[model samples]
Each structure stands twice: as C-alpha cells, then as structure tokens.
Target: MYENLDDAELLRAALDAMNREHNADAVSLLKILVDRNPVHPYGHYLLAAEHMQLGMVDRAEEGFARAVALAPDFPIARFQLGQLYLVKGDGALAKSTLAPLADLPSGTALASYAKGLIAMVDDDVSGAVEALQTGLACEQEILPLAGDMQRLLANLMAPTEDGAFPAGVETTMSAAPLYLSAYGKTDP
Candidate 1:
C-alpha cells in the first residue's frame, strides 16, 4: 500500500505509524523505504529500531551497523550499535564502536551515554551511574533515547537483595529496550 509513496512521504507515514504505536505498520513502511532507497542511513536506522522493539537483536545489529557504515558521523546510530554490542556481552567491540563518540562535544547526551556504556563494560557501576545521570540531565533532541537511558540508569542503580547495591555493573541491558524516535528532514 505504501509503494506509491515517495521516500520522504514513506518516512513520514512510517513516523506516523510509530507515533500511533502501530509498530507492525511502521516496520512494513520502513522495510519498503529501505528497499527502495538502500543507501539512506535513516531508513536502515528506523528498520533496525523496529527490529529491536521486536526482540530481533541480530537484525537490529545488522541494520544499525549498515546505518553507521553509510554515515560514520551519525552519532545516534553509532551509539545504538555500540550499546547493542554491549548488551550482547561483547565489551571489546562495544568499546570500539562507541569510541568515536568520545569526539562529540563532551557534555552531549550521546557522549555521556557512550561513556556510561564504556564504564558499565569495565564494571565501574558508580561511573556508569554518574554518566548516565549526566546524560539524562542534558538530553534534548532524542527524548526516546533519553527515556531508555533513564530506565537503564534505574536498573543499574537498583539495590540488591541484601539492601546493598551490586558491587559491579551486571548486564541489566534487557531491563530496558532501546527506544528510537522517528527522524525528520534532519538526521538524528
């Protein structure tokens, strides 16, 4: 049904579907968008997000990776890919993937998120909590991502059975799923 729409229109329709919580329709539209415009990074990114929402980790990784490969400077895509790796228990790859985000302005949400993930991988619970809190404080552009980070932070800071916090950062990645906002004319 969406085949008749041009790329821009298709993206808008997909965004509308997502806003309305019609994930299946949004996924269908995004798949068509990516198939028709294979080189558009946002299309791949959006499809990857749908895959993530559906618990299809492998597909999400592939889509996010494609998006990052097509647009190296796309910080959100890069951060998501890296976080995916971190969640999958691949710390080395996650660190490598998130490394470039360090070059972003230091106080930006993406930068803080990357730092938080890196600290988590290193088992530094306190550091991760601090960075994630900092990220939540300043996050503006991508509210969905900020919400995801907030959930992650809450999980990380949750206390253990004995009323003491966990000594190290355990992989609570599954406690919060990645939430992606729809892209507009500008790339997120």
Candidate 2:
C-alpha cells in the first residue's frame, strides 16, 4: 500500500499508525522501509520508537543505536536514544547523552524534560514537577503536551499556603480556559 509514497510520507503514515495505537502495523511498515534502505536514520528511529511503545526495550535500544550510527548529529534520534537509556535504568549513559544537549539553546526545553523524566524515575516527585513545569514554560508551543503536564504538576504541587500571583500570571491562567473553550478543547 505504501509503494508509491515517498520516504517522508511513509514516515508520516508510520507515525499516524503509532498515534492510532497500531504499533504492529507501524513496525511492519517501518521494517519494509528499513530493509530497503538500511542506512535511513528515520526508518531506524521510527522502528525504535515503535519498539519502545511496545515495551520491547532490547529491540528498541538496538534500533536506536543503529539510528545514531547512521546519523550521529540527528537531534531527535539522539534525544530518543537518551530516553531509551533512561527507560532502561542506565543513568550513566542517559546523563552522558543528555547533559551536552542542555548547553544548546534549541535543546534546552528537551533537556529539561529529560531531567524531569530522570527525577520521576528516581522517585523525586517534587523535582520532577518543578523541572517539567519549567520545561513547559520554556516551550509554550507545546500547548497540548504542556497543558497535560501543567495539570499533573499542579495536582502534585498544590500550594500549602496562600500566595500572591505574579503580576500577569493569574490573568494569563484565567484567560487560558477561555482560549481552550474557543478552540473547542477541554483544558487538561
């Protein structure tokens, strides 16, 4: 069915399949592409992600390693590789890969997110909430993801004492519900 599609289109189809929870189908499609183009970093990356979603950690790690080998500087692949290591409880490797990303301005929010994941793994709930919230603040374009994260953090870090709002923060928060309503989505 994907014979006429270009590589990027094939990748999009695989992502759509993954989003719809058809992980086996996504893997099959990605495997076809990877078999034909072994060095295609995106093919490896997509397969790696599918394997990760399916909880096949060993296969996921192998696929991610191949992606990194094929495209050493591919930021998304590197980020996911770090995440795989984090999931495997390989803190040393995760830190080694993710720490350098923090110094790059474009990678700042992602690096912060990785830190939050690490904190959660370490059972430091407060640190996770703080780090993820900071990351969400720094990357407002990630509204859907950040909104869910903000709700989770708010619940986790509910204030114990009454506090004054920063100048426009309350106004911004109050307006958010209106904006979300206008967009026909519930705030998470």
Candidate 3:
C-alpha cells in the first residue's frame, strides 16, 4: 500500500537498495512498482532479481516469467531467466532461452556466457572450454567469470593419463585477466 510514489521513483529506490545489497528493501520497492504498474516488464525484472539474490528461486522464476511474458524482446530479463534455468539444471530450457539472444548486439556476451555455463554443466568439457574462450575474447569484462571458466577449462584440457591438470592451468597469475591484460599483470 504505497501512497504517492510513481514508478520511476520506486524504480530509483529499488536500484539504490539493490546497489547497497539491501535485497529486502529492493524487493519492497519493486513490489510497490509492480503494484503500480503490473504490466511494466522492468518491475517484474527487478523483483525477479531481488528474489534470486534472496535464494527464492521459485518466486524468482515466476517474476522472471512475468517479465518475459510482458516483454519477450527484453534481452536482459531473458538472459537472467536463462541463467536461472541453468542453475536449476534445465539445460535444454536454458539453451532455448539464451539462444535468441546471441543475435543481438547487446545480448551477444550474455548469450555466450550462458552457453558456456551450459556446456560446463553438461560435462561437455571441450565445448565449454571453447565457448568460454570465445566468451572471454568477445567480452573481457567477463573476467570475473574467467577464473572459474579457466579452472574448468584447465581441468577439461588436462592430460587424461593420471587425470592430472595440464601445465599452467592449476595456478592463476591473475584473478582479473581483463584488468591484467589492460594494466599488465596483477599481484596474484
């Protein structure tokens, strides 16, 4: 029962709370926004993200579905929905959801990242390695994901004789490869 705030104001407050990691407050603001504009796709998107942060996957799924239903062309929400599907072990659904995004300029990196994760989850080691490598090449800002992706790739590309990791794979010289590439190496 919010009194006078408009959708933009509520959205602003939600973003502020989300930035502060105040997920509960973000959810409250998003709820008010949704109440005010149930058909607004972004409201549902914010709610879904907050719910995901809170580990309420079922509710998050519902909100994400609502967002997609309201605006099927919304790339970011669809990408996040695909990620949720991946987390739920629904590889087929995740791939299907993420596939269309690959064609959009804004969605290219996200689609690649999701596909890479899907490949990893399916134990398609070589495929994951390739996808992750391409993802990194396409979007270096995905460096945060690069560490785990590199670890996974290293394990996949490891020699199968004794199942030991291949050389230069076990240890990383940088957690932020993009930053390292930009600034010329990191401390560790």
Candidate 4:
C-alpha cells in the first residue's frame, strides 16, 4: 500500500510513525524511501533520528553524518551530530561540527542553544547565560509556556560551576512526568 505513495507522502507517513513512537515502522518506511532515493537528505535525517531513539547509536551516527554530508547548509542535522559527539566525549569534533550553527540567525533558539553549548565547552558561563537569555528573549513568541520559560531561565542561571544547569534541571528535563508530579503539577 505504501509503495504506491510518492516520496513526499511516504516521508510524511514515516514522520508520523516516528512521532507516534513506532520506530520500527518508521525505520521500515524510511528504509524503503531511502532505498528508492539514496541522496534524500530528509529521509536519511529522519531514519537516523529514529535509530537514535531506538538506541542504535552507530547507525544513527552514520545516518546523521550522511544527512549532514548531503545537505551541507542544514543546521539541525549538524546540531544533532554535534550533540551526539558531545555525548560521546568527542569535544573537538563537537566544536567543529557545531561551528556552522553560529552562521544561522543568532535570534533563533536553535542557534542560541548551540552557541550556549559551545560557550559552555569553552568555559564561558557568562557568555552562555547571555546568549541563552538573548535566544529565549528573541523566541518568546513561540515559547510554549511563560511559566516554563521563567523556570528555565532561573534554573539556567542557578547552575554551579561544576554542574550542568541547576540541580533540578536534568531531572525535569529527562524525567518530565516525575518532575511535573513532584512539583504538584498533576492535578487531574
């Protein structure tokens, strides 16, 4: 049934599947799409992201690297690759990988976050704070919740030199449900 759909439709379906947490189906659909069009950058990017979500780091890296190679001007792929490198403790590669993100519009949250990461890497806490504040200020219109943004700003500035963000930062981030409940947010 899917074979009859065009590339765009197939991609949409794959993205929907991925968003719905059907990684295996997303991978299957994306594999077919990529097999049909080897140079499709978005296809490779989505496939790589799905693999990453599935804990297939090696394949995810390969897909993300290929996506970056195919679309040199794309910043999101580069950001993902750079972050992956950072997670893997390849700071040098992460720095070089994220260098291009600076060329993106400074007002964008994406660019600001990338700059903040780089500043942190360079041990410039103040610079990171300033850039992040600027980014958040610039992107306020799209900020999901005003309270969340305020919390983020406060937590961001409260980090000790040795810690990443504040004490509750990682917890709220990676464990959103627990964080929300702990903060008495689960009323229903």
Candidate 5:
C-alpha cells in the first residue's frame, strides 16, 4: 500500500504513525522510504529512532550511524547516536561521535547536550548538570530530548541511599536507559 507513495509522502505517513505510537507501522513505512531512497538521512534517522523506541539497540545504532555518515551536519542524528553509545557504556565512542557538535554555538541545545554527555563520561557530575540545565533552557525544538536531559539531571541531583548526591558517573549511566525510549519526534 505504501510503494506508490513518494519519499515525502512516505516520511509524512511514517511521522504520523510515530505520532500515534504505531511504531511497527512507522518502521514499515520508514524501511520502505530508506529502501527507495537509500541516501535519505532523515529516513534512516527516523527509522533508527523508531528502533530505539522499540528497544532494538543494535539496529538503532546502525541506522543512526548511517544517518550521521550520510549527513555529517545533521546534529540531531549525531547527538542521538552518541547518546545511544553513552547508554551502552561506550564512553570513548560516545565522546568521539559527539565531538563534532562542539563546533556548534556554545548556547545551542546540541552543543550543551554534547558538553553534558562528555562531562558525564569524564565523571563530572556538576558539569553535566550545569550543561544540561543550559541545554534545557534553550531547547524548544526537541521537547523529548529536553525531557531526557531533565530526567538525567534529576537523577544526578537526587541523593543516593546514604542521602548524599551522586559523586560519580554511576547515577547518570544508570538513568541513561530510562530516556532511551523517549525519542525526539521532531523532523531534523
């Protein structure tokens, strides 16, 4: 039923399905889109995001990597890919994947998020919290991503079993998975 649709139409349908939480349908449509237009970075990104929502980490990682490879300037794809790596406990790879985002303006959401993630990797909980707060302040486009940052910040700030705030990366890493299922729905 979707074969006849153009790339734009297919993306629209996929987005609609995602909006309605019909991930299977969205994945089907996005797969067709990427199949028809193999170099479309957005298609791969969306497909990867749906994969993430469904907990298909490997496929999501591959799709996000493909999207970033195809469009190096696509900050959202790069950020999400790095985030996936961080959640998977690959700090080095995550830092590398998120490195390019540093070129973005310091006040931008992606830049701040990248800084936060990198700080988390470096075990700087205070720095991560500061950067995430900055990101949240300027983040209006991708609400879901902001929500993820907020959750991470909350986790970092929360006291441990001994009533002391987490002093290392453990809390951040532990809370990372909770935000994985919350993919950004905005078109990048």
Candidate 6:
C-alpha cells in the first residue's frame, strides 16, 4: 500500500495500479487513502473505479455517490453515476442524472452518445439522430457508438420498412477504425 508515501503519492500509486489492471493493489492503496482522508473526492472516485473493476457494483456505486457528495461539480463522477443508472435499466434516473452533461462535462461526446441512447430507449428517433450526429462531430474518436447510431439512422431514414440500410449510404467512416470490443461495461 506504500504506507510511507503521502496522500498524493498514494493516489498516484493507486491510479498507476489501476491503469495496469492491478485492481487489488489499487483497492488496497485507495482504501488506505480514503481511510486517511475521507474528504478526498478523487480518492473516493478512484476507489469506486477499482471497485467497479472488481465487479462490486454496490460498493462502486456507493463510492461514486460519496465522490459526488464530496464534490458536486465533478462531471466525470456524475457521468459515471448516470451510466450506472442506465446499465441498471433505470432510464428515468439515468436521464435525470445525465441532464447536466448536455453542457457541463469537459467533453460532450460521451454525454451526447448517452443522450442519444436515452432518446432511442425512449423512442425519440429524431432526437437520437441529432444527439449522435452532434457527438460524432465533436469527437470522431467516439466510434464505438457510430455503429449503433448508423444502424438507428438507417432505420429512421429507410424508405421502406424492410429494416435495410438505404442504397449508396456513405460507407466511409470519418472516425478512426474501431476494434471489435465491448464498451459500456467499464468506461461507456
């Protein structure tokens, strides 16, 4: 746990461990950090992330909640909490939690994607397209959502009800090529 280190060093070590996927070591260090400095919002957030990586949803949610309580203006914590609500299928809660992301987050791309997902879940097709397009324009690196948005847009724009994409639809991607990997599980 690097007991000899100060708070900042401990946090760095915890984050380093987390980035390396050593969640157990990160959790141990973060537990000590939060224990020593209960008011440390980032400490709580890091702890929450480690907990999430360990598949401990309740603890992760609790830690995230604590971080929010400690620092209400932290957009990342709010975004994460909203994602958690969405994953839990609490659409109303997720919407309310994510309402601020339309303007407040450091980058709005993820927020827009989330908004698009919420709109799609709510059957607001036009709203979904608007949000997805806005998000893609803001950051092309957000390509994981492109496939979903493309499918949805195709459905909405299809002349027929056959569930097929329109002919001559732009096949070229403006975003970088994407890997076939799962998202919305860890970072969304």
Model 2 residue runs over 4 Å out of place are: 1-6, 115-130, 140-188
TM-score of each: 0.85, 0.64, 0.71, 0.76, 0.88, 0.69
Tens digits of per-residue lDDT for model 1 on 1-188? 66679998989888788778788998999999998999989889888888887889999899999999999998888988898888788999999999899668977988998998888788787888899988888846777677777777887788777644364434447534445433222334
- Candidate 4 residues 64-148, lDDT tens each? 8998999988666787777667666676887888888866876777677677657756756577677667667765432332234
Question: What's the CA error at residue 152 for candidate 5, in Å?
Answer: 0.8
How many clashing residue pairs, candidate 3?
0
Best by TM-score: 5
> Candidate 6: minimum summed lDDT over ten consecutive residues — where?
172-181
By TM-score: ranked, best first: 5, 1, 4, 3, 6, 2
What would you estimate as the lDDT of candidate 5?
Answer: 0.82
Predicted structure 5, TM vs. truth: 0.88
Cα deviation of 120, candidate 2, in Å: 7.0
| Superposed Cα deviation of residue 41, candidate 3 (Å) | 1.1
As a TM-score, model 1 comes out at 0.85
lDDT of each: 0.80, 0.62, 0.64, 0.67, 0.82, 0.64
Instruction: Give per-residue CA lDDT, model 6, range 1-188, as digits (tens).
Output: 26689998888777677667776888899899999999998888878866776667788779878988898777667767666665566778878777777664535676776677567557565676788677766754435455645654555555645534334222311111111111221331
RMSD of each: 3.2, 9.8, 8.2, 7.1, 2.8, 7.3
lDDT at 134 for candidate 5?
Answer: 91
- Which residue pairs come into collision in candidate 1? none
lDDT of 2: 0.62
- What are the clashing pairs of model 5? none
lDDT of 5 by residue, 1-188 (tens): 87789999898889889888888999999999999999999999889888887878899899999999999998888998998898888999999999999679877987998999998888777888898889988945777677778877887776567644475445555455445434545554
Give me the overall lDDT of model 4.
Answer: 0.67
